[model samples]
Target: MIDLVCNVSNAVKAVDPKAKVYINIGGAVNLLYNDRLLGCIDGVLREELRSHPGPSGPEPQDPWETPAVLDTLAYSHSHGKTVLVGSRDRLKGARSLCVRAWSHGFIPVPQPAWTLGCSTPPRQFGAVAPQWLKATSKSIIRRPYTSIQYLSLFDIL
Candidate 1:
């Protein structure tokens, strides 16, 4: 994960060396709520969306974290930075984050609803059948499943 963060930070630094990039280093949601860290971040890339269920099947963290994440989001937006929340569930926390981000002049980018593994193919709408359409469509359609699997595979690392 340090490598991943470094990669992203390095890429951003390469493009705009003055840009300050902050990475959250806990489980997905924990990273979402740390205001002190968020306060320093010029932009955020929230990579995972699901709340991890504890031994009892409820979230392991305090429920208050949700609001804290919102607070961090609001702060990021007020700073006029970009906040990209990547998640499998569009309705989970994405809607509120986007609404708040846009209200504060932050650019909000969301992952598509079919961003997680689902058996059904996504509906595609286009004016014409472009070259490599079939390959591109298949790749796009398979992304969620592939991504989920890829993330899971990293757990062993």
Candidate 2:
């Protein structure tokens, strides 16, 4: 998996040097510790900071304050990698988490209602939309060694 991600990233950069590759590895801190994988991608997207451990299991650790998570964020930032932390909750809860994320230097992605897409709730929550979300790009990102083109598909929720 690491090799695949690295190869894909290298292949993408071979064509469009400025294009970014962001991946969501489901908040795996161990994977974040992988320097090779870290070097390839532009950013990491953590779906939910407060993810459920599992049914009938212990609650999850606070990702924002967890030592390993903080270390991972620091490590990624040191390599010029963006770490986007997202949370799914009510408007107020989203705002709170967004603040927490920003305070820790991690970009916050608030999902009030995924069905509404990216634009509407940002305005409602008074949060600034990220650059990638604010505009469209003509540059198409393709998979490594394949013809599969992944367009800049933002605001699609």
Which candidate's TM-score is highest?
2
| Model 2 segments more than 4 A misplaced | 53-65, 112-133, 139-157
Computed on alpha carbons, the lDDT of every model, listed in order, comes to: 0.44, 0.63
Q: Least accurate stretch of 10 residues (summed lDDT) in model 1? A: 118-127
TM-score of 1: 0.38
Determine the C-alpha RMSD for candidate 1 after optimal superposition of all C-alphas: 9.2
Model 2, TM vs. native: 0.68
Residue-wise lDDT of candidate 1 within 1-157, one digit each (tens)? 4445556556655765655554432345444345544444556555443354456543533577556665665666566545544443354655654554345544333345344221222223112222221232211122354321221213313
lDDT of 2 by residue, 1-157 (tens): 8887787778768887877788776656678788888888888876556644456643566755466666777788778887776665545467676678767777766654453354423455566666664544455434321111132323112
Q: Which whole-number lDDT from 0 to 100 does residue 156 have in model 1?
A: 19
Candidate 1 deviant stretches above 4 angstroms: 1-41, 47-50, 53-61, 90-157
lDDT of 1: 0.44
